[model samples]
Target: MEIGLNHYLVLSTLLFAIGLIGVMRRKNLLLLFFATEILLNSVNIAFAAISHYYGDLTGQLFVFFVIAIAASEVAVGLGLLIVWHKRHGNIDLDHMSTMRG
Candidate 1:
């Protein structure tokens, strides 16, 4: 079967759902960060599709910026996660309640 706009949309929707579920259910900081990235990427997919449909490049340009933002977010998130793990001796988010002032 040939792929079309609907197929792209369906894929984006499915990815969004998975990411939402992951964000809601996962406790690990790493997984939480990953889920956030997935959500951002799904938006990129939809924007690219809409741009293609309208013969406009603006949406695609926006997606590229989103991707750049997501990459920076992942870097910061992982760095924070590592610091949290080192301080707490574990990665369980529930145990990380205190932040020094």
Candidate 2:
């Protein structure tokens, strides 16, 4: 049997679920970033699948922009994480509660 849009959508949904669970359960900043990446990737998969199904390039183009934005987010986020870790020596989300308003 050939793989179809439904298969792709189901896979995307599963990945999104896993990513959501990870985001909800993880306490570390680094792990949270990974979970967010997973969520972005799942959406990318869905977009590409639909773009292919419809023979349209819009979804694929949107995926590329999303990827670029995700990359920039990772770069900025990791930079902040490094600074936070250097100053606090830990990357736990609980530690972030001490931030000043």
Residue range 4-100, candidate 2, lDDT tens digits: 9999999999999999999999999999999999999999999999999999999999999999999999999999999988888999999899766
Predicted candidate 1 versus true structure: per-residue lDDT over 24-90, tens digit per residue? 9998878888899899989889999989988999999999899898888878888987887777777
The Cα error of candidate 1 at residue 1, in Å, is: 6.3
TM for candidate 2 is 0.95
lDDT of each: 0.87, 0.96
Displacement of the residue 24 alpha carbon in candidate 2, Å: 0.4
Winning model by lDDT: 2
How many residue pairs clash (N, CA or C atoms closer than 3 angstroms) in each of the candidate models, in the order given?
0, 0
- Candidate 2 worst ten-residue window by lDDT: 92-101
Model 2 misplaced stretches (Cα beyond 4 Å): none
